[model samples]
Target: MKLTIQRHQKGKSYEETFDVASLKVTTLLAALYEIKAKMDESLTFDAGCRSGVCGACALRVNGRETLACSYTPHDGDRIEPLNYHPVQRDLKVDKEKPQETLKRVLPTTIQNPKSKIQNPPLSSEDEAKFRVQTDCILCDSCYSACPVLAVNPDFLGPFALTRAWRYHTDPRYIEEVPNDSIQHLTSKIQNPVLLDTVQQNGIWDCTLCGECTAVCPQQIDPKSDIMQLRGESLKAGYSDPTLSTPSFGTPDFGGGFGFDPNAGF
Candidate 1:
């Protein structure tokens, strides 16, 4: 099979093609290894766990996000680094920048509102609330497929928003604190600061395009998580900035036809 790879070196970008004798079940990572071992020693990419579990080998194949370790390569397949990330080398992208959004959005640890009770109990139902979200492997496939990042680089992308929703909905954070201390009573309320942080270039900025969900290798639905965040934001007395605009409502027609007949066309 012939594979065309997009390569970046020193400050230049180029394409290189290599022919590999591959079996029907040969994965893209295997093909890359073959090319690197026999054809070009400099051929570069990232891979770990050789299975899809690691998510370290994620890249763009045929202009779509996929794991190199799992996907079988077709003849004439074009491989490249993930979109919206700085290419470290051929087929390798710097994920640190994209992942930094998580640190900026989520608290270092879950803040238990019930201060009197250390290690609050979490029921099965509470665990199920954000269970699927916890499966995120940080593959960054969702980040690669996100259209929001194409235009708004600063926009907190899908994974970060999903993580924010994960912690926000955590029952530990929402449980009522004991009335032993006045400070505890005041802190019993939900985290408005988290909602506030996600309001700008965050949840509201998401266009609800399901691309992030479609590309997530782990089946984690970031799009749905973002919607849940929006609902929580509304419940917390926060509104979508776009919806609050003066131009968003229907125009009054003075009980006449939609348009004034007296006005000349």
Candidate 2:
């Protein structure tokens, strides 16, 4: 199989072709590894926990974001580094930028409101809350696929927003008083982390393009999560900037709109 690799370093980019017909590897990472080991030792790329759990091998195949370790390459496939990231070297992009956005969201549980739970076992319904978000392996496929990042570099991309949603909905962050108050009325002041995502470049920026969900290897839908986050943000008294626009409510034009009957045409 023939492979075209787009490589770059120090602001210079180039493509190199390789023939891997002899090795017969099923996955792209395997082919690259074979080439590195046998053909070219200088070839640069990133791979960790080859089972796709680590998410270090995320790259573009045929212009789509995917995990190289899990993707099976086709003949004449074009492999490139992820988009919206600074290429550190061939097929290796800087992860620090994306990492920083995630850091800003505060992934850890911040100030659990309840010291001890009266009920020991969590209900299945409660467990379902955070179950999907936990599947995210931080592959950054969603980040690369995000069209918002293409135009707005400062946009806090999908994964971060999804993570913020995960933490916001966490039962640990809630003070469960059983029948004391409606679930919606629970005070948010106990955990400040939930409110952190209400600022600029938060959930409102998302265009709901669904590209993030399309590229997510783990099947985690950051787009859907962000929508849910928007709802939560609204319930917390934080309104979307777009929602604040004053509606004129259909311009009232008396008697045939622009022309008056008394005025001669």
Cα RMSD to the true fold for all candidates: 5.0, 5.9
The TM-score leader among the candidates is 1
lDDT per model vs. reference:
0.82, 0.79
Which residues of candidate 2, in runs, are more than 4 Å off?
107-121, 174-193, 245-265
Write candidate 2's Cα lDDT for 93-196 as tens digits: 89889868987776444345354655446579877987999889888889998988877898999998888877766666543333333334535443344554
Models 1 onward score TM values of: 0.85, 0.82
Q: Give a tens-digit lDDT track for model 1, residues 167-224.
A: 8777666423333342332343365556667888999899998999998989999999
Off-target runs (Cα >4 Å) in candidate 1 are 22-25, 108-116, 174-189, 246-265
- Model 2, position 50, has a per-residue lDDT of 89
Model 2: which ten-residue window has the lowest total lDDT? 175-184
